[model samples]
Target: MERSRYLQVALEAAHAAAEVIRHYYRDGVEVSIKADATPVTRADVESEEVIRRAISTAFPDHGFYGEETGSHALDAEYLWLVDPIDGTRSFVRGYPFFSTQIALMHRGEIVVGVSSAPAFEQIAWAERGQGAVLDGHACRISQVHALEDAAVSSGNLRTLAGGPRWADWAQVVQRVARIRGYGDFYHYHLLAAGRIDAVLESDVNILDIAALSLIVTEAGGVFTDLDGGPVTLETTSVLAGNPRIYAAVAELMRVPG
Candidate 1:
């Protein structure tokens, strides 16, 4: 299939999931604790189902890896990564920070992505080799090269706070002009649209960051694991930023002896 078609399908899947999420958002749903201690709701499961159906109908041969439904054919040439609701806790609390995340990974590369924040009224999409778009306008990361002039955002820092790099993280906080924990999809969106210079996170699943990673990279920013490694299925940490800020942050995050 054409790359544009992949993005089209991803957007459609995100939209379909958004409908399910919005309905549950307004009407309310019961939450259950997953074994990982994260919360899940009917909205999450039903939304994944709807997204899966939409993608399957469009390309039955492709694989699927979803937060709710789990994986199928992960090694397939083409795979769909779905996160029905990226911020369930916020959604449950009516905070409107939740979103539907959908991405297509082709031959181990995330070639397309669609992030739809229904409640937030924001949508961003990207195709590999093409630029990113946020709400119908092309977007790019900020050019703030110096740490003292850059704004950095973080998410899910529990692991970082407990690890050897805790001081390194502190160094980043002390050096940057501003720091905010805009956790979940919001920070990535901000980074991609030139609103923020960088985003760091120490605990995340592939489903959580895959789409956002593509969005950031396509927006002329770099996306990598905290170790400065390429993104892959096992990726759990992130250090994303505009090219210059990314290099600066990545160097600061290196583990100290």
Candidate 2:
């Protein structure tokens, strides 16, 4: 299939999932705690089912890895990663920052990505080498070359406080122009659109970072683990942004305080 076809599939699935999310948005959806103690909602499961059905119908041979249902057929040439509702806690609290993320990986390389903030009516999508876009407008990362000039962000502070690298957060906080709590997929969207300069976080799943990885990199930014290594399915710490901020954050994430 053509690259555009892959992107179209991802976008369509994202739109379908977004609808499921919108239906439950701020309607006091029931929530349950998963084994990891993270909140999961009816909206998350329903949205993943919607995305899974769409992908399976369009490409039955492809593999799937979803936040709610887990993975299938990892050895397949193509894999779709889905995070149905990336900020379920926020969603449950009537926050509008939650989003649905979907990405297509071909032979281990991410090729197509889509993120939809349904409550905000904002969507960002990109195909490998095709650049990123927000609501059909081209998007690019900021040119802020120095940490002092950069606006940084990270995951939910409550979770980060428990992470092994919690102390590292202080170094970044003290150095950057400012920090925002635009947790989950929202940070990546802002980075890709040049609204934010960098995002750092620990305890992330591939489904949480995969789509944002492509979108940020395609927007002329860098996306990798805090050690400056390539991000993988198992990567836990992420630092993504323009190259300058990425390198600076990587240095801050170094061991031995």
- Please tell me which predicted candidate would have the highest lDDT against the true structure: 1
Q: Write the per-residue lDDT of candidate 1 for residues 25-82, one digit (tens) a residue.
A: 9676899999999999999999999999999999999999999998899999999999
Q: Residue 110 deviation, candidate 1, in Å? A: 0.6
Cα lDDT tens digits, model 2, 1-257, are 23487788888888888888888988988889999899998999999999999999999999999899878998789999899998888899998888888988888889888889998899988888889998888999999999999999888455668767677778888999998978888889999999999988866888888888999999999888766677677777778889888878778777221
lDDT of 2: 0.86
Per-model tally of clashing residue pairs: 0, 0
Stretches of candidate 2 above 4 Å error? 1-3, 156-168, 255-257
RMSD of 2: 2.5
lDDT score, candidate 1, position 42: 97
Please give the range of 10 consecutive residues that has the lowest summed lDDT in model 2: 248-257
lDDT of 2 at 119: 89
